[model samples]
Target: MAEKNYYDILGVKKDASDADIKKRYRKLVRQFHPDVSDDPDADNKIAEINNAYETIRDKDKRAEYDAMLDNPFASQGGAGGFGGQSAGGQSGFRWEDMKDQFGDGEAFGGGGFRFDDIFSAFGRGARGSAGAQSSGTSGGFDQFGGGFGAQDSKGQDQHAEISVDLASVYSGDDYSIKLNVPVRKPNGSVDYENKTLKIKIPKGITDGKQIRLAGQGAAGHGGGKNGDLFLKVKITHSDNIRLEGADVYQTLNIAPWEAALGDKVNVTTPTGTLGVSIPKNSKSGSNLRLKGKGIPAKHTGDLYLTLNIVNPEVNTDEAKQAYEQLKQAFADTSIHR
Candidate 1:
């Protein structure tokens, strides 16, 4: 079978301009983005799109790829292919040299845009597999996608992102994930099996930190050890909360009188509910720092309460009169200098 064409994958013509290519790429990405797409193969489609765009988007790489397409036999030697002799009865090319170029899946850079970036853009995490191969040519399929040869080699490691709730980070919790993993059959054939594994989220685990699972990645060949799986943690929080390292900032709503006169109010925090005092004459957007009340790490972190004053509606006559009286009281106070 012929190799997949990059242009066909991106739905673009060979003579298409850069702008056209970029526009097509964006359209395809939106159509196949896992978050919104209903396609079952959206994940694989995205990987193919990213790989094709990364190559064709670059001028130098595109030129090199075009040359290869124009002369398909140049790299494999004129007429001489992998088997034994050339099509023009010349000679067989060196299999070792071809293996050096395409084997081990490093030739194409393993998909430039990683899966983590795709899912992170949607404010979530993703689980998927790529280039997962088994040891040996079990099912008559070689590790390099050809029927040429087989050898004992360790499988490649896999990476994915996992979303962890802020509450879960405050207190460690257990989570489970399902994946389609390679299972090496006793007959030496490789089979993809759905498996579930439970993961532990440690307390105070920050975003971008990875958790490694041994022997949970692609299966190895010829008694080689299986590759490990790495899960990068992404800490997720509500819109009202923002985190800066170990410090947590949350919006605290208070009344107008509470801001003018000191008052105590209860706040429901990640740790628990606590009564906090609203300082007298406090303004909106003021931060109240509670030391060592953020994430419960070794050093601990601080929690900041940003005050947001909200006013009650003055629809009732009594309410309107009260507001009028208050307005008269503060009429002489200059808000702006």
Candidate 2:
């Protein structure tokens, strides 16, 4: 069989840009993640996406994989992989004929199976002078080119990115997430198992920080402890709010008169709406600070309101006359400061 195409798995073309690939990958992760999704195949789907992403995300790895995709013998294990034995049959030893001769535990000791045993059994010499590379019982390939099963080996830790909106960060609530894990079959094949977990998102959490779940990663080979799952938080922000650490900034638009004469106005904050006083003769771009009003945590953050003065349109004659008078009054005034 041909090796799977990483690009196709992510629903992207070979020419897709890095940004485009990231967009698609994020969408798929959210779709198949077991903690939040209801689909039974979500775990397998996500695992596929993760594998594709890890392979194609690197420039050198992608180039190497692309070259392999064009090669005829790429899947047959290249030079070292058994690749199902159809290629090695030209020398009178058909790989298909050995189906009844070898079993997993029949040839090798308790460590693991080796492909070299097959070559030795047939007296055709080993696959290579180096012999079959043993992966201990933990992870190396078998002599017949089979892959490692769980074998009680500790599962590997898995990583994923989770995107959260600003509201969730402010609330610091517990969230449920879903994921699919790989389960090794008796025949050495692997299958996906979906799982969901309730996790707590730390309040005042910043982007790029990670939260860890114990025993939530890939299953161990046999009775080995499951690996941990680490989630890197990606906080998605909107144009309406700018968040930095505990500091929150928002641009507040106000009438010109309000800035010149001053007034108490209600301002919306991450916590809630609060009435704040605008100082008299305030200029546009003035900052109104509300201490300890941004995010609620051990160390509270402040909210900074940037004032933007807006002049009303002079469409009516009365408004035009008022503007003309104001212009005349200030025309000779030395307000250059």
Candidate 3:
């Protein structure tokens, strides 16, 4: 079988811009994300897409991979050409094949051979005798092609989005999300563990704010500290209401008579229920601002009630007669004029 092309996987051209690649990756993620996608192969597709994006998105990695594609045996010396045979005398050796054979370096033992080891090996010059070419103090491929990192490093941070209810933002609440989190086993192999995390939604947290959970991301390698998980908040509100920062706007329907004659009516808002007085001869689309009733925060926001006049159906004789009287009483009032 032929090797899969990263560009083909992401559906982008070789010369695609960074923004274009990002947009394509996001689109593919939305299509294959396990939570929302109905595709049976969503999990595998997502993994493949991630691997492709991770490789090509980086300059060094992309250049290294391009070298492999252009000429698998371009590099001279002990490391070989990454094809046919490697410095370790392994035939048909390649990073992707090795990843399939030993996942997360678990096959060899804990902290054995990781997928990232490929980058550490091929992305840089081969270390000469006496470790002359080694760049970092700890982590890199040794002269003998052994993958080792003397120093433990912190894991990469992970990001996700969470939908927060507007009401919950008004009054703090708890939320839960199930994630296929990566777990580092004793054997050094990484596997996904299905776990639920409880998140505390702080009051007055605006949209696009982030909540950080420590030690919730990928496990650190070689006993390094685990990375933090960041959750971007997305405030969700009902169709009748629109939220803008700390301010809340809601549509309040009122009877035509109440709008014209002015009256006190009870209204249910995000904060609570209150009796609001309608000014005499109120018109549709007029706003009634309630002081400091918006989302609760350090700087409180105001809630605006937009009036919408609704006419009653004149089905009964009494109602029809009332409408007839109202029409006659307002007959002289030319609304268009």
Candidate 4:
């Protein structure tokens, strides 16, 4: 077997740039990955793809390979030709003969051509045996091709975090978040691209909890399905409220009189304003619990309101006089208590 045309095996031209070759190589990998593909020749096809990519992935080696492609007698020593030591005076090089330089399952880079690299473009970096999803990122991009047959193995799952406002979490509405996505460049380097993906946020989602959106993650090659997308919910700080385990905590400020004489005060919450009644003789640090008003969830959360009494300034003579009279009314022991 004479040296197979690396370019032709990858379905590209000899003059094709590394970028062009990589583009074709990935497409072919998707179609022929043994774990996903049932093609009888998938393994052989992928091996060839890996072999071709290995030779060309390296700049110097590709140059030498290119020279040989142009003229079989180009290399120094005309070493055994490419196909192997010509027996019976048979001449010329074949790529398969070069396999001797490296063992099976390894590429020219001292590494194996991994399905991970290919799937990384689709956003999954790790996979379980037989292509089952182990772990990965949210999304990815690459330079390449069309469709493929269904995968024999399932697609890998992807993970990401999206920050959501407290109000949005309270309402459990659909949220759109931006991701600074890492993409594989034509030269096989990494670069970033901003992607805006719309994923449904589950109602009553809590902070630090992950929401799984199926089939919205890393895309699958061939007939394989895209992996699942897991968005970890990160609740942003609210101007007036703090959240904890689905509970909403807020501090309510009331006038001294309101605390002493009991008052119906209107309080504002993320949902809306409500008139809450304060009990007579209510002191600071007192908490008022509103049932089922915290986060909207299956278990339901409660809103806890803590009251703080604010005193009127004694800047005016009349205010000072009023304070004196109020102070005197309460005996020393009562005041101390």
* lDDT tens digits by residue: candidate 2, 117-217: 64555343434322222322211233322221213345557898888876788888778888887664443234678888888889888767899888888
Ranked by TM-score, top first: 3, 1, 2, 4
Clash totals in order: 4, 17, 0, 12
User: Which sections of candidate 3 miss by over 4 Å?
Assistant: 1-153, 186-188
- TM-score, each model? 0.56, 0.53, 0.60, 0.51
Better of 1 and 3 by lDDT: 3
After superposing all C-alphas onto the true structure, candidate 4 shows an RMSD in angstroms of 16.0
lDDT of each: 0.67, 0.64, 0.70, 0.61
Candidate 4: list runs displaced more than 4 Å.
Answer: 1-156, 182-193, 219-225, 335-337
Choose the strongest candidate by lDDT: 3
Cα lDDT tens digits, model 3, 1-337, are 0134677778898889889998999899788777688988776676556556655666765666566556543223212222212232332234445555667445467665654654555443442211223343221234423222212335557899999988899899999999888765543334678989999999999889899999998776545678789999999888889988888999999999899999999999889898999999999999999989999888999999999999988889999999999889989997774
TM-score of 1: 0.56
**Candidate 1 clash pair list:** 79-86, 79-87, 80-86, 135-221
Model 4, span 29-60: residue lDDT tens: 77877657888766556645554565566576
User: Which lDDT value does model 1 have at 148?
Assistant: 22
* lDDT computed for candidate 4: 0.61
C-alpha lDDT (0 to 100) for residue 137 of candidate 4: 13
